[model samples]
Target: MNFVHFATDIAHVSGFSALGLFIGLLLVFGIGRYIGVRWLLATESEHTSAGLLDGAIFGLLGLLIAFTFSGAISRFDDRKEMVITEANAIGTAYLRLDLLAVETQPALRALFRQYLDARLEIYQKLPDLKATEVALVRANALQGEIWSAAVKACEVTGSVPTTNLLLTALNEMFDIATQRTVVALEMHPPTIIYVMLFSLALISAGLAGYTTAGIAKHSLTHMVVFAAIIAITVYVILDIEYPRLGLIRVNSVDRVLVELRKSME
Candidate 1:
């Protein structure tokens, strides 16, 4: 698998990664403090000359955190919206199945039910990407079968109005499925941005430690709190990004589809 896929897999268990990051930050913080104390003793200086540089790095870190957190929220909202859209589209098409001849309705309705199940299963399978892929393939195949069945029924009904209304709905239903798949898989920011965020966070932690060198005693409380806050923020961002695999999720929004499926029965 590519790095993106690998990273996504890691994000599936974001809690562990966040914990690891927290530990690493604390270690780096201590190392930075040690180095700073040594340098202070050697130079016998009261203050460092890199205040401007420190400010710039911290500023950039804050900016990146804000942007990434904002973007994750936006994507999380979009995923929830997409779930509602798909549910609506599928419901519309299912109702329009009535436009077909009565004899054709049962078979098409059955296919619609199966198709919806496949769609739900795609995400419900979760961090098992292979199972999700299988579910997706099943869904795509069901889409083709649904379209073909709907077209055949329309031909039998011999009503242009019925064909237009029913086929249009089916087309929308199918289109939205593809669109939802794209959004779920490809809507994320580039991996490099996340890498940069992580790297900058570590560097800033080190600088923060260095700044405290002039203090007579190191503040363990401040160091721990700093690391914990950043680690938690990063975890939340990643959790929001991969809703299916993480604690922050859009699965609740999927109840719309579940209700629609029940209505079909």
Candidate 2:
């Protein structure tokens, strides 16, 4: 996960929602504190057993957190690469438009330009199903218009094989656009993972605080550092999941868009 994108977005949105995710984390810590206090009261047993147990819990949680963190980062990178790949596909399709026909070339290029603009808009404003439904109606309408132009070109060319190439490019463009939508807008942290991680974080902290109680004055360092670690890691996960919504988003078209548009000329 792109820590920068996820953290900033969560900080802004969650902050506005009365600290949505953070408040929840805070609550978890609170519960852990309560549990630690209760457990300590119940067992004042300072056997080396307590320290060993604490060490084990910390080690396990640390390992799990590290593994999961790595997984999230890997997914984020995959999403980024997907964006670049999709952009390349669209750009390649657009350039292939030149292979159509003389009369069809300029008009086909115009249609591609419009499609790129529409696609960029979609990337910038994530499509809610409702809004997307409306936008898709418009997109379908635009697609019809574009295809009509392609049909005109094919008719002028009078060679099915040559025209087939243009049609194939159009199909490629569609696939790339659809792929972009998934990687850029919908790729997100799974809710189940979030729930599990959150639960684990609370459990870890409670155990850590409880174990270090008498031997340490519940050092502010550990709690603060843990919060920072979990929060930062989570923030990165979120950023990666939401590409278009943050600074770290994989560019929808990147250089490909400009290059393709230039090729049209």
Candidate 3:
């Protein structure tokens, strides 16, 4: 089973979850308003002393949203930066192929081209995670072939400086590939964080509704705007976190690799 598929599925689920949360927030808000109205009638008091609790809950919700939103943006930037880094690394390593014997350059250069294609294909196949996984595996295999070919070419050269420089570039290139894979697959915050976020959002909505109960009538506009903003915020966060599978994406960054591949030709 491909873990990329799992991640993509999770992103899809999160998107749907955000939509559900919008409706749930509206429902919970109405229910809380009903309860608050009954409480107002029973107590016959215009004000309640639980202001501190409301502040705390809303404060916590704000904190969670801020942190998650920030983290998602940071991750989104990292993914874009990774694409550029990988492109540079591959280009550097490809250029270093000149250090090898004239006869050895063609095969290694061809491998580099194939490797870059595989890398690009991995993301190009996005949302179709099975295809992406296949591309990823192909890229990994090319990494090994490139390394082994480079090692053999270095041995053929029998020059310490050439071997060191060429092999170092190859190593960095492969390392960046591994790093990109890890970032794409494993860098998300724990699932519990998102669960807590959703829970807090709903709780905050309920509290907001309860507070608004003091008013004689419900403001449909205010309620809708509040729920929409929260839902959109959550969706954007998730979209940024899983850029490949969402409206917010790092696909533009792939152009770096595409340019590098064009240079190879």
By lDDT, the best candidate is 3
What residue pairs are clashing in model 1?
A: none
Candidate 1 vs candidate 3: the TM-score winner is: 3
Order the candidates by TM-score, highest first — what do you get?
Answer: 3, 1, 2
Q: Which ten residues in a row have the lowest lDDT in candidate 1?
A: 40-49
Question: lDDT (0-100) at residue 32 of candidate 1?
Answer: 81
Q: Give the per-residue lDDT digits (tens) of candidate 2, residues 60-152.
A: 667766766677678767766765665676677666666677666877777777776666555444423344444445555667787788778
Query: Could you give candidate 1's per-residue lDDT for residues 146-170 as a string of tens digits?
Result: 9899899999999999999988888
Model 3 residue runs over 4 Å out of place are: 41-48
Model 2, runs deviating above 4 Å: 1-56, 125-140, 183-189, 262-265
Kindly provide the TM-score of model 2 when superposed on the true structure, using C-alpha atoms.
Answer: 0.74
Each prediction's total of clashing residue pairs, residues at least 3 apart in sequence or on different chains, is 0, 4, 0
Candidate 3 TM-score versus the reference: 0.94
The lDDT of each candidate is 0.84, 0.61, 0.87
